[model samples]
Target: MKDLGMNLALSAEEKSLLELITPELVKIGKDRSKLIPILQLIQEKLAYLPGEAIHMVADHLSISPSEVYGVATFYNQFRFNPPGRNPVKVCLGTACHVKGGDIILENFERKLDIKEGQTTPDREFSIERVACVGCCALAPVTVVGQTVHGHMQPSKVEGLVLRARIEREKQQREKQKNESSE
Candidate 1:
């Protein structure tokens, strides 16, 4: 496979993941029509598509990296960056907007120190803006992972972030304890 010379770097874990998925990618076929399925497989394996993996897929299909990226970007299901342990989605639907959803979203940006569609440096949290969460009654809502939090306000941002941190810490500690027991 040819390198696109983008000089993208993959972490040890990412490299290992790519190695594991490469065989499947090849078996799926190298035709350009197979691009979407290949990309889907990669995302399913890695949770998000890494740049190195994108380039490798392009080479495998005898296409340019941009071609792969273009197709991937066209689909909303694809994500280029890694998702955080806690993914925060702010609803900006018409009802939520009227209830000050933008303000709530801004408060989260300030508290998290990361803009929409970006993950924190520590990877503990990621922020995204959603068109709607289908809960107009709870306008100005924020969903963290699978839980829907309603009637959110700017004042509640700090507490929400703090709670996520505490929960993440607890999970980490539990994971460590389990590993030690093993």
Candidate 2:
């Protein structure tokens, strides 16, 4: 008898989504065949790939864990760590490159006091760079959460970040006020 490795149990929500994907995985035959979409599904369901889930998926599909890790690392869209409550992705694509993205990124690095791929000490923000966001015409653009600021200048970077911080503080204060009122 061959040991098939550890079996993974999914949470109720994850199981439901996996069941929906079971047909698709089955149709693909090998786990390798289903690997990408499977990963995507899990990421969508769980926000990030749990280590256990990755191992389970690898075992089920007869692939090595390293292979799974490799795939996960290769894709920028996929996040290995749980993203911050707010994730800031600065686009460094070619158009942005010429538009002083380097300076902007540096400013963020200095102001945030954290390198790229790092979250703030308080965990209120996480900074990262993307290859291209297709807003090159606006070059030197920064995306804070979902909002994008284009044509950014070196001098404007600090102000933009400060503005975002102030805005967030305002929202938090407003929420607190509402809670007290309630």
Candidate 3:
């Protein structure tokens, strides 16, 4: 819903994200050296940069849009498009792979109706593969949100997705409650 091509008024969500980072942003002044922090703040706020936001940030910080976009593109953590509510990361380390992590990943793809690096149609979930998470002692680990489930079996995919969906709903409810109070 963000039009990345135009300079427009900030939405409520955009303003909330800005507010969350204002303290850190205030520490940064007009110097171009702050470009990295500015980009980082934006990325952390929205998970990605709306093309229009790049220009907005550049103007606010007195820098170049090209510079903002360059930094945005350079970082793997910064995405141009919006990501799903819950990003699912599956560890595929050598130990995990040997313990059937590959099958577990495939199981997730099938059950979630989305492939690795792709988000579901409803944008509820996004799946990704990680090289390692240093949890090899518990090989075959899958992380949904911040919860890590070790020694995963292919059959556990449905439950993992279900738990993620439930958590997202709970988070959404909490967000709505806070918004209503505001």
Selected candidate, larger TM-score, 2 vs 3: 2
Per-residue CA lDDT of model 3 for 58-143, tens digit only, reads: 88787778877777666666655455677788899899999999999999989987667666667677778899988898889988
lDDT of 1 by residue, 1-182 (tens): 22222233455887898899878877888789999989898989888887888888988999998888888878888877677778999999999999999999899888888777767777778788899999899998999989999999887888889998988889999999999999
How much does each candidate deviate from the true structure in C-alpha RMSD?
4.4, 7.1, 5.8
Evaluate all candidate structures by whole-model CA lDDT and list the values in order.
0.84, 0.73, 0.75
Candidate 1, which segments miss by more than 4 Å at Cα?
1-13, 173-182
Single out the weakest 10-residue window by summed lDDT for candidate 2: 1-10
lDDT score, candidate 1, position 156: 83
Instruction: Report the C-alpha lDDT of model 2 over 60-148, residue by residue, as the tens digit.
Output: 79989888888877887676544555677888888888777888888888888766776665556677899998878888888888888
**lDDT computed for candidate 1:** 0.84
Candidate numbers, best TM-score first, in rank order: 1, 2, 3
Q: What's model 1's lDDT at 165?
A: 90
- lDDT value for candidate 3? 0.75
Task: Using TM-score, give the best candidate's number.
Answer: 1
| Backbone clashes, candidate 1 | 0
